[model samples]
Target: MNQSAGAAQHTHRYSVEEKIIGLFLRTITQVCSAFIRTAAAAALWSSRLQMLSEQSNFSDDENVPGSSWHTFSLQFGVWKDIGPVGPDRNWKGIGISLLVILVVLSFIGLSIVLLSKDTGSKTSGSPLTLDDLFQRSFQIHDPDAKWISAKEIIFQRWDGNVFKMDMNNNKTELLLKNTTFATFKASKFAISPDLNFVLLGYDVKQVHRHSFLASYLIYNLYTREVQELNPPEVSNSALQFASWGVQGQQLIYIFENNIYYKANVQSSSWRLTSSGQDGVVFNGITDWLYEMEVLHHQAAHWWSPDGSRLAYLTINDSLVPTMFLPRFTGSLYPRGTEYRYPKMGQNNPAVGLHVITLDGSSFTEEIKPPDGFHTRELYITMVKWVAQEKLSVRWVNRAQNMSVLSLCDTTAGSCITKHVMVSDKWLDGQNEKPVFSRDSTAFFTIMPLKHSSHGAFNHIAMISNHSSGKDVSLHHLTSGTWDVTHILSYDESTNSVFFLSTEEGPSQQHLYRVSVMDSSDKECLSCSLFRSNCTYYDAALSSDCQHVLLNCRGPGLPQTTLHKLSSMREFQTLDESAELRAALKNRRVPKTERRTVQINSFAFRLELILPMDLDETQKHPLLLVLYVFFFKFSATIPPS
Candidate 1:
């Protein structure tokens, strides 16, 4: 009973015609979801990330050799602004000549000050590592929308030499005692759709690289006890996808292209839905090429919000052309890493999207298509069941010139479409997140208004699928130039969307709130949430929608702080470890002194840094000066 390969596909490859139709459906769905998701998960991570501080660095400048270029520039900018601009742009005029002469003298004085100043940007010593970096980069008092998420607060510290922090009585405590490393590591995590727990992780080297079972430890989080969610024996595969359900414990992850599910989080038993290892048929995981170039993930998959079925993009890369590049390690011969890659306007994976039931029984629906579509592998931005049987998936076209949002009717197994968005240039398709309202009648999407090259000025479009016997149209949200840094929060309970915008000035961010409404444009009823921004960072709202934990930077100190933002913006700084505090206190405190100098042909403003530890205030030896990048640096005191 071996059927022909062509005869076996209940869901065949999509023709260009089918892809067009799908594009239409997804666009409408995206607009509708954008309206809903705009409110649904807006507050998802913000409640957990809240940190802001008002502290001061010992000195804003340091005139020391090998100081960072940024620090020197900071000092230089301050010194130059000390004088006003010259005589209203008239240099040859009488009053202008005096202004010019005086300005020139001032410049010379500034250069002299720089030459004599002891300014240093960085000390590179072990104790003053990231803390110093944070303080400088983050300024919570006048922040550019900075945020820090103190992810895990554990009882017992995590081993493996990783930096750890713990929460103890309204303050964060450094728990990993007696360890040489004093800082935490960057987290690679995927939060579950259920929003109950976050799936923290490692790369392929830790998981499936050797054997799948051996690398299963990554699935479990917080045995050390900060926030624990119960889930059955679910092992995160190497180089794959995993997510939570809307209800918290339900989980889905890809294993060998096959999609698997565990209903209860605490159980170890699982059942397979697709026999994806057949190598030809892909289930939940994306093939290497699609995951790498287009999707930005090694896996091409997603979880439906309600968490009933898993919708995934499958790639049939068997026909794609492969190119080989030689790896020469200065040897006579070289080996190569062989794989499939799509060149500009070239062959790509035959893209297809499908929905599978959680029971491993059958496909809830398979999108049928024509042969003109490039169906080998498709770039699926996201998929969700907007309503009971209507699912939406955003699909990008092969040329990368346009993206098509498709809405599929699960029960009918067909899709009525709309061409939501079309771009003539490259764009960040992932930014096209589809948000749905609680009732699932309408949604919204924020997409590029012009071409991708000018995305900093993109427009937010609100599309509706309500039908209502009228023209379901698209509405624009932004009036002027603004780029979104983070959709900090969306509260359906309160009917508002909180997002960070750069409309104030380029490179600086501010928090803004917009009301969500119905067809009449009346305000929607939701939560009464507050907002706060001390410095520039991103944040995520917690599940309760009341808490926010973030990394905030002040004048000289950037630390993690937790805030109960929904009710009030109160500062709760994490406590520092005694050892770390002691180390910092004992380190050389560099004080910046302003000076001017004339070095070569350039008049410069300099920052002089003198060590504070010396008993004799003015007397010191070896005021060695070093010039780098044409900027002179010196220290009034030498290292002991």
Candidate 2:
């Protein structure tokens, strides 16, 4: 019985030893599996990190995703929580740890590289500076601003080459090349009436408000020849005025204040006036006062529509008071320049309206002013040839309160007043040239309506040119609350008047066509017909009224466009400021807002400009701009 008990105890001990061995083997297996899993995961993560790093180096996209260092750290922490396997079996764990560390390092390197690249990209395209802003703020003129001939726009480029662009297809062709003439370059140019010659002004020096002294050149289109327009007596004297006559290649110029004429390129120049004296008398050209206030033109001359006669103003400023202007340039002592400038209630230059025949008949006749006015102070505001033998002259009193429109019979040398308009305020209608009817029996002018809702808004009126007294009947043509800002043209074909008005709004100007036969028939041509981006507008109509050059001035970017009148479709964009817009695409710009405030009986219009990215929570300084008439106010805000 004792031997049996010993064998049983031995068996129990063996059983316990076997169970412990089995338990160790199972634990070892589990550790090996965990190590294998950790190693596999590290390899996978390492490969992924390497792939992501390579992609980041060459990838164009910035939103690519990769294993972050935090995520790797969290994963590594979880793996570490599993604890290192037994030291005898921890080799796989160590290798996995090394791989994970390499992946983390790679991720850090790639992240730094990506951040640097982003910073470099941001630093490359810098913001615009003050100098850049000023440089780009210059006005870019619409090439077709001044001269458009025969459906073609003519302009001179900076290189002094003249080009003509066809409005039909926007095709341009070189018309004249630069011709050097004695150290002078062509600075201004105008085409002839027949488009056969280009009159060029070189070495131009501005003298007064509207007058310039320049040497002249005549460029022949057919022969491609350039000729100097120098008078025989003077070698290089600057001409006061050089312009094309109404006839084909006929030229008229003023030298030293005297008028000279040329029938053609090969013809000799003849002196038309010999009474011109420096600072005393000016013939065929305005003095400083007339240029500044009355005519606003350099030449005070008019050519007959048939090109048969020339009407000019002979201004005598001998008795007018002299004003001195100081000139400060490259000199220790400033020199005072004396000019005849008449102030209010002072004696003005005596202006006379004279008509001279261009047919070699030295017959010059003067149209006397009216019955009761001092000739010395009476100002001849406008002179336009209405017919071959008749001319329209406007005379305003020295006080500028009363105006008299007279029709002068050039053949009879007699002037008769047709209408006398008296205004309590200053009369502004003297600058408007009346549009005569086809038969010259009536003329159209913008006159204040007797009864209107808008309080003395100017409207088109047809007045008889036959009446000899102030009782002439005036027929109202266009009656509305808005004022007709300007009369563009009188279409004889349609018996309609084309004008620009503030009919749309005070801030906006649009073209309108109104019929004289039916005063109620009017059409707004440009109100609803822009590219949804333009607000203010100005237009230049073709001679035949078949096409119009529309200038879209902005609340946005300004652009010039050509359109067909018949179809009202955009032909082409002449100047869109594409380069300027492109440069400003990524730059900050100021925001503008317009509002009108009514204070008592006065309504004041104001425009505000706010800085870019303006925050309402922050305080901003304000600026108030005021002008004499306060017609428009524009503000600019700098970037923060």
Candidate 3:
């Protein structure tokens, strides 16, 4: 009876959003599959390491005194295949002793694995649920810009369709529709900093069996042309548009650990800055964790607004210990993938800052840290050149308690550590990157502010029986319950600061553009520039601040659309497909709506999206897990 109920529940869940659910289930399954593949790879590599060591032993050229440099070979005796004392069966004492020792060692190894760590700790595991992906404020900023473009994952669908919606003007154009191939779904994309070109990538099969593939396509807006940037013959995809070299003339992308560069508008040569191998100087780029987590960027290097010399990260990984993903095989040997990841309490990769001079042979300067904290405790995520000779660098300490923001003079090779930001929680989870003012005068940090007025439990002291104290500042930013959204860019021209905030309340993203009086006062002017009444809004600003793009989703909209912020007018409406839209138009159905929910003394925007088949009898399981570097809950029903 219980089995039947469970099956019914599972079936009901399928009705929710089969497309998204299938993707989730597939994503989850791939985790375990990848884990096994990694295990197998580690095993094979272990054998290769042993073989290489043995070959070195054989090839060793040992020089003996009073003798010419000649190859030396070691000759050792071993028990023969023939029997021992009498005729056939030989009782070798060493073989029995080896067996006993192996048994003892195997027992000890098993015990250590079982007792030292919990088996559940191996996998990162699926976060809370589908809805959670959108709830957290991971990539939020001050005074959210009007969005220029967007990429939204739809439910009940497999193929990733990318639509470029121009909010405020109301023109929804399809850039890349869904593909028939499931594995070739468009996963990531980037527009040239010049806004002239676009790059799209899809995850596919890798060159080796254990590797995964990433492919790219470059779209030119002026020429209305489309071309594949990567060579068709190679097995690689994980490609990205690192940064625009000035007029979008040069392109930078990463394939595995290697950084590739290509010039635009001609038959140009591809230059390799990184070669996947360690100990190489990386030009115009950052590493995986820094890109994936910290700076909220995929490109390691950044071209100045002028696109002159590039400011980027150069990782020195000669110290970090590599942890291999282990794969188990049912066959004679297991196949797998490999990478070097620094485990907790282990030596991490040494990070440094580098400035690449594009005028000639690139010159490099190492922004080495002063040896005070242990080397393993430092993590660098973002670095930007403040001027032709000045650089801004941020590093999170090992304890994650405080991150010291520093300015480096590339001219003198000097570093002046400035701001010290410590987490009020006292424990650092994944932290966000700092945003610099355009002039590079001051930096911004979006931290949590505890609310003492509500009398809620606050501090998570690193001790047993932690005190449930009220919200208060102890060398912190604020003393109330508020988490800072990301620190958006500063507009020096107007002395206006932009960022997203839950200062009103969480669950909704509101635009807050604060006008600063001076460095001392730091007071916000009452005359506001713009505000959004919705939960999810992404914005981009023009240099003059006259034009702003706001991508928003209000109540009842499954897909997000665009809007112009200043006028708060509809720019473009994003739809699923032409056919679907026509079919829906044929039916006289009620249009969806966005509600103004009161939150934090402010009316917050909340939009709703529902299934086409709105039968009350129909039930779909809702998954609400927040995504990394984001602050919204996205829901997707899994396939049964």
Q: What is the C-alpha lDDT of each candidate?
A: 0.47, 0.73, 0.48
Ranking by TM-score: 2, 1, 3
| Candidate 3 Cα RMSD (Å) | 34.1
List the candidate 1 regions with Cα displacement exceeding 4 Å. 1-214, 218-253, 264-282, 328-332, 368-378, 385-390, 416-419, 427-431, 449-456, 467-470, 485-489, 516-535, 543-560, 565-568, 573-640
Q: What TM-score, over all chains together, does every model reach?
A: 0.53, 0.71, 0.52
lDDT of 1 by residue, 1-640 (tens): 2223332443233335446555555554565545444433433223211100100131232344433312112363342122221122222343444554565556555544443332222232333345664652222221111122333332222232222332234443442332322221223344333323445443334322212211122233344223222223432335345555555577666655666576756655354554565434566665655444555454555555466666666677666677675667888889865556666666666767766666546555676442234564345565656775677666665555666666677656676453345566665645345666665555666665544444346545566665331357777554355565555555677766655555654434544556666423422111122222233433545543455555443223444555565433454544212233444553445544444455687545555454434333233465767653212568666434
User: lDDT of candidate 3?
Assistant: 0.48
Candidate 3 residue 324 Cα shift, in angstroms, is 4.5
Please list all clashing residue pairs in model 2, or write none if there are none: none
Which of 1 and 2 is the better model by TM-score?
2
Write model 2 residue lDDT over 383-478, tens digit each, in one string.
888888989888888888998988889987897887789989888767788888767677888888855444787888888645454446678877
Q: For candidate 3, write residues 140-241 as lDDT tens digits.
A: 212122233233211122234544444345454554444522333555556564566766666544332222346776667567576666532354444434
